[model samples]
Target: MKKPIYRTKDEELAQIFSSKVLPRLRRLEFFGIIMAAIVLLVVILGVLALTVFRFKVPDIKLRAVTIDNYSNLSGTLTRFNLTLREEIVLKNQNFGEFKYDKSEAILSYGGKTIGEEEISSGCIELTYTKLVVVLIEPKFEGLGSNQNLGGGTNSGILTFNSYIKLSGKVNLMMISIKKRTREMNCTLKISLVRQAIQDYYCH
Candidate 1:
């Protein structure tokens, strides 16, 4: 047999594999391995989103909203699941897969609650903000007046302020992406006027 290779105590080792210098590979438990993998994946994804993707979200806006079938009731609420359609503009600052699950519209007059409605559930995929419509129900039928939902009714030329709240999640569209994080919904608001229609909502 050839002589075994050996080095002096102070010999310079070109390819030295000293036990102290070797990487310590402990016998990993299943849970530990899984946890490590998840952590590694998260760190990589976070770096990607922060660096290559540079994905981000901005506030949403209600460009144009209209109350349809406003004149159906003859001086009272016509009670037909009244529809309020709106045009929204979303601008995505970063490259990301954005989506929406639930949306809402809250209408308040002069800083008092008027109505809060649930528009719909949907998904939007992209970095750029697009216009989306929300249909909400006041959940109550009433007369030619404004009323705060969960509050009570107030009347016309009233201070009309509205808030749109959203809930959803997003995915990073990349090969390196493994674990996706839940994204909070982007939302916006619009100030509007609700003129007393000749027709109204009556219970």
Candidate 2:
């Protein structure tokens, strides 16, 4: 009779694996995966906190404030076709509180106030000029800067000057972490620049 080549229990079995019958994960790989997950979670949370619980200002809000009903304007200009109309857009962009009282807009060219418009908003309009551009072929007695934009250059002479004063209620994050736009009187005086020129040789 042939004896089976069977090993006895006392001889012991090949230790396939230890523990609860499940494949054990390597310590280094497990720790690496855990750390990666933790870092991802932390980054996501940080981004959320900044986006939801702080002062967030928009790029620019072009709200029409002029008496005219138009928002955008475009036209070609010349002697016979020398007329252009435009509506102003005021931009409000800021993280700090707005000082809408001291802000204003003044137009000038060659050291002269050919036209002037005032802006007394209660906040920031840094993205746009307070005095929206007004294009025209004005009757100038001497050869100088008409200092008006939006005329589309019908051939002659033109230049533009502008000053923006942002002042008003500063938008802020409330205690509940909600963004609020509130008006507060502040002083923001943008300087008046008038060193522009335009000479078309319109002999």
How high is the lDDT of residue 55 in model 1? Answer: 45
Output the number of the lDDT-best candidate.
Answer: 1
The residue-level lDDT of candidate 1 at 41 comes to 100
TM-score of each: 0.44, 0.32
Error of model 1, residue 102, in angstroms: 1.7
Error of 2 at 8 (Å): 28
Per-candidate Cα RMSD to the true structure, in Å, reads 11.9, 12.9
Candidates in order have lDDT scores of 0.49, 0.37
Give the per-residue lDDT of model 2 (tens digit) for 28-131.
57889999999999998898667533444333222222122212122323221122222344444443443345333444444454444454444443333343
Error of 1 at 91 (Å): 3.0
RMSD of 1: 11.9
| Cα lDDT tens digits for candidate 1, 80-124 | 234456566655444555655565667544455446767566545
For model 2, state the Cα shift of residue 16 in Å: 26
